[model samples]
Target: MNDDTGGGPARGVSGGSWERATLEKLVFATLKEQRSVRRWRMFSRLLWLAVLGAIAWYFLQQQTLGAVQSTPHTAVIEIRGEIASGASASADSIVSSLKTAFEDRGAQAVVLLIDSPGGSPVQAGIINDEITRLKGLHKKKVYAVVEETCASAAYYIAAAADEIYVDKASLVGSIGVLMDGFGFTGLMEKLGIERRLMTAGENKAMLDPFSPQNPEQSAYIQNMLGEIHGQFIEVVKRGRGARLKETPDMFSGLVWSGPRAVELGLADGLGSLDTVARDVVKAEDIVDYTQRENLGSRLARQFGASVGEGFFLAAKASGVQLK
Candidate 1:
């Protein structure tokens, strides 16, 4: 009976010891899982903090640069790429830069560094008017230094400058307007497809590529283009005065080399930004007053554009341009 009782106690103790060991193992495993989760959460938080810190630093840097003042320098506003309403070389951005440059006490003169194939005429006209107004108000001479190609709308803005400088090999003309598109009517006919378009007014579908060409509409568009062309010619005449040597093909949508342009009185002489700054403005040091879009703004613009790309394409198909 004693042996039996001893055996029973020994078995009970062994079972209790096994249960305690299993419980200890489970507790340790649970603690390890919690520790891993906590580490990951901490790492994620740190990563987000780092990104926020970087963005803050970038904006602060830009603000600091804009606030700092320096000795007398030539303030440059870059007009590169297509000068559309929402583009980098837009009238609003250029005009804002011009205002800042003109207002600054350290700015000796304003320089327009142009390199473009041209874009919207309306935008160019706004910039041209502002340049003239600013020049009169501030009494600061504005110089246009052309690089590569300065044509159509680009030249429209440059016309407001006191003088225009260009490289010898640069293309400096194409003083004209255009409205470009493709006619898919022929292709649709070949593919045996039908176009069912609805419009509120007869003229609403005037330039629709899928519809047959209307002679009356075409004539009206031609007349309107001629009027705009006439206005462009008058602007050039006013800007160049007696310097321009008018020719039959001067405004015939023809591009000219820089040297040829100077001979034809389209430009002043062969010069670059550096030479013009040192000789004309008398300021060797240059400071850019151009307003640039920040990273966040660019990313937001890109995201919005992606969402509206289809709508933009449809409108662009029938839009007029100055190129």
Candidate 2:
């Protein structure tokens, strides 16, 4: 063996084996580094899975709602919610529902089973106008059956109906226009708050409820109320025609029970929803058209509404200071 050179055949073989062992260690370390990269990718994949699950849940909810609305039905409609613009009997809600009902082939007639204390005049007028137009176009029979109360704007709407029925104790008729606001003159004085109002016109702040009332202002307000009341009287007379009894006390903003209403010629008969549906509309099926928002959606809407209201209040409080 060439021991001096350390390159004898056997010695050379041992050196080559040592070099291969060193190379193997480096390759194993590189494999472990690649494994660490794979572990990071797995973690990211898990996060994306959670995100996808949430998205899938949202879509599933939406699909469920869509399916529920797709269910079909028959017969008359139920108008048993509050009547107001943007409040309950919103124009959009009522008109859309009415349109759907009219389009339904099975629906023979539209029955307004009303039981409300009345609300927004504009909303009521719009609804009345729509009802009139729809009746003329479709030649459909529309009946207003007052359950408990159909006063003010509610009665206004009822006038548009082909016929009106009421229960014995139902309070109907508040045919008048009235505005209410607190007079904070005393409270402001008591609290030592300064009154600083600047108006471009004399009547710009004519109806300011915070300021003291002058004789001229009082006369103006009375005249305005009288005018509105006159409008209400005219509408009632037009709708009821010869059916409305001519009496000095008829337009006295009097509220009467259902039985009293019939005596007063405000309603045609006495009955309830079922009686009206079976007897008048001749259909027992009822459909609701009012908006149906979920609790979360409703809460979100309420939150946004309250926020907007607070913003306006802050602005009015800072500038107008009028009640």
Candidate 3:
């Protein structure tokens, strides 16, 4: 029995040391956690600031780039996409740009820089009428300079111009109207699917793809298309006048080479935007006068439109669409 009571003091000191080590580990872990939280918070704030800065820069850039100057130039309005109501080449956008270009005293001539396969006839008609009206009011010559393809409604718009120019390789005409869709009645029968369509009006579901075709409705649609076609032909005739060489196949929804188009009087000559500006208009400087929706605005509009479209599609029956 070598005095066990003396070891009690040593045990107490060892226990105290163990307690101190445990407390130190806890404090270090707590500080590390706090540091990690601070780093994450800082990173989040930096990311938020970067986003704000980017948005600010985009707006500033748009403001700077969209500014119009009172300098002499050939004001060019680009019709480079579909001519639908919401498209860049829509009557609204093109007409607005044309108005600006024509109103600008510095603009020597208003040039329509067209590169499109065409779209809505209604949209084209609006643009055409506006072009004619603006030309008469402003006393400024409107010229159509084709790049890739200017057909159908695009040609309709070009017809309003004083002169139509094209590159040798460019496709220049497709003077026609069309309504296209699919008939799914046979497919539905094969799949044993019943189409239960209800409408308040008799002709409400007249062109429904899921339903059987009505002969009267078909004839009506054909007559409607023929009338529209006649209107298109008359417009072409009025615009081209003695320049057009009358041919059966000319207005048969057929596209022609730029040289052929020029020969047929669909186009005045083979010339580029540069040539038209420098040689024809006598203004070398070119300024873009096309009013365009900015990226952010377009994105927002498209998103909203897509959401609305889903509901519209669900509620409506499939039908014919014009191109």
Candidate 4:
């Protein structure tokens, strides 16, 4: 009976020990898992902090670069690509760059390094007006040195320059305006697809590609374009003064070689950015004051666009209605 009692006590002690060991193991395992999770969370936080620090550093660097005041130099503002609103070569950006360059005491003269086919006339006009105003305000000379092609709206802005220099082979001129669109009414007819477009105003659907062209609307548009072309001609005449050699085809939307342009008085001389800076401006050191889209701004724009697209898709999926 004593042996049986001792065995029962021993068995109870063994079972209790096994249970305690299992409980301890489970606690350690849970602790290990928690530690791993905590470590990952900490790493993610640090990574985010590092990214933020890098972005801050980039912005600070850009500001520092912009704020740096140099010795006497030829300040250059590039009017490249299409000169339209929201573009890098937009009037707002060019005007802002011009203001900075003209305001700088170290800048002797401002140079416009132009290379563009052209874009919005309104944008070009705004830039041209601002250049003239800034020149008068600062008593500084603005030179336009054309590279490759400077036509239409590009030439409109260049007209405001004190002098226009171009390469011998560069294409210049094309001082005209145009409205372009694709007509799909015939295509729709061939496919037996009918357009059921409704508009409150008759002219609201005036230039709709899917609909038939209206003679009255076409005439009105032509007249408007002609008026704008006249305005462009006036601006060029005012800027170029007597230097412009008038021709019937000068404002007929035709491009000319650089030498031909100089001969016709569209360009003053044949020169490049380097030559203009070194010889004409007399300030060999050229400093670019062009306002470009920074990396941070680009990233933000892309992120915003992505978010907008996501919302649009979600709304479409949910069948959201808008009036």
Candidate 5:
């Protein structure tokens, strides 16, 4: 049979170098067989690159959409969520929002939308101080529109507003100070758990759960509450001025529904954010400046806050009140 070019395998360079010719043919055949694999691999890599590019584009678009924007023409700020020390929705957040509103040339008046049950008295006072400062410095009118629940420290914050509004059913008031925790001395005894505590002053651990309540301790804690209460009362008096019709029972740490709140001068009007913006501000446009609490921290706070509030309400119901 002919091995190459119709000639049998021969000596080197004989019959047109039959062996070299056969080798060339074999090499050419291998290259032809590999061509499809190389081309397909390149195509697949290109396709994957395109897919990754699309995914990156989608994420970029989502981020832009999720970012908060400053509202032009009218500046509306929010103080929703719990107000606490160093919280995202705390005094600093509201203060910064007010500052931004005042600085914005398009903002006619700063709108403060509040939705909180209040928090630290110190935080609330700081917020009130900042509101006063911003108003004085900027000479801009600020309105506090209450939503859901603007009680206690929330009202303290709202008191600094030029006007106040609440929904018909929104909970308001709770104009008092409180501190609640468990007394676990008995529980510790039952659980056989020893509580190790140290303090320079005997009164330093007055509120400690593991410590037994002393008469002097009770007196001291009451005095502290009274002092905070007085500060809260003064803030409300200053904010509402003569509009506030102070009742004997109003400021006893009692929370009320919006209707009673409006009737008692705790809240000026009754309506939600939508109604207030449309009718009160006379502008449909609104902006939010409130910072949302992260899920982890928010949930962590929920239990303690709710339990403390439940006890506080029970105490208030038993005869104590707030205005």
Candidate 6:
């Protein structure tokens, strides 16, 4: 028999070569997979490091920026927007900023730049108390400058200031308390819808919109509101002292123009922030001492709440308002 026709060295050499080629291909594929995994791992690590670095930089900027100024300037804390808990004009932020501004030696005087319809009597009271305490401790003067409107709780806060300045046309003086909400009981009745509510206490669902109005509850609410209104009146009286001219409509939740407010002793005079910074404080330079939320703080606050939610909770709990 011929060697080529049978299983011989030539056929064996070809089979060995084929096996070697397959082995080499398998090794290459394994190396390639490992390289891919390593690349991905390195990329993941780099991304994580980048995130950490960004966070660190952001924090560093927040700590260092606007911390020091060479010149003596008027420190301004903005009390704009709705005054509620955790808001920019809230007691926490406003009081903290006021403390910082007062503590700063470079700041000649602290200015509260206010422009709002006002909100949250408790929050405003906290800020007002802090301002008074800080003034006594630091011996720093606080001037409230109103841009547009400083009614209700805003006036409560402004009353704590040394003096209040407003534009001629600015609306001011709604020093009162009120609780406003829509009653859906009538609407539900019109729609022939019955609300099924169950609670541990009869007063648990006291302010439930869908429920029918209870006479006892209404009287109780009115009494509570009256007490809080008395507190508000006391705060304004204490803060304003003899400056507040006692009038029937002053604390009756009536709003007034800036000129009329000055005439009624609700405001001191008509002046803008620029004029006050330049003429009153005698410091033409104005430095903002407002504790504004940075990116990190804002992101953290996103998990928190809004002003409306705070007002709702306050109303639900206290059945009172300074809005």
Instruction: Give the per-residue lDDT of model 3 (tens digit) for 169-243.
Output: 999889999999889999999999999988999999988999999999999999999999999998889888999
* Alpha carbon lDDT of each predicted model: 0.86, 0.72, 0.86, 0.89, 0.74, 0.84
Kindly report which residue pairs in candidate 1 clash with one another. none
What pairs collide in candidate 4? none
Tell me the spans in candidate 3 whose CA falls farther than 4 Å from its real position: 1-67, 295-323
Cα displacement (Å) at residue 135, model 2: 0.6
Candidate 2 lDDT at 147 equals 74
Stretches of candidate 1 above 4 Å error? Answer: 1-60, 63-68, 295-323
Distance (Å) between predicted and true CA of 304, model 1?
13
lDDT of 1 by residue, 61-148 (tens): 8854773446888989899999998899998889888898888888888999999999988899999999999999999999999999
Clashing pairs in 6: none
> Please, what's the RMSD in Å of model 4?
6.9
Estimate the TM-score for candidate 1.
Answer: 0.76
TM-score of each: 0.76, 0.68, 0.73, 0.80, 0.66, 0.80
- Ordered by lDDT, highest first, the candidates read 4, 1, 3, 6, 5, 2
Instruction: Write one digit per residue (lDDT tens) for candidate 4, span 203-285.
Output: 99988999889999999999999999999999999999999999999999999999999988889999998999999999998
Name model 4 segments beyond 4 Å from true.
Answer: 1-36, 48-52, 55-63, 294-323
Q: Candidate 5: give its CA RMSD in angstroms.
A: 16.1
- The residue-by-residue lDDT of candidate 2 on 70-149, one tens digit each, is 33332344455567656556767677767766665555677777877777777877888898899888887788888778
RMSD of each: 10.3, 11.9, 10.7, 6.9, 16.1, 10.8
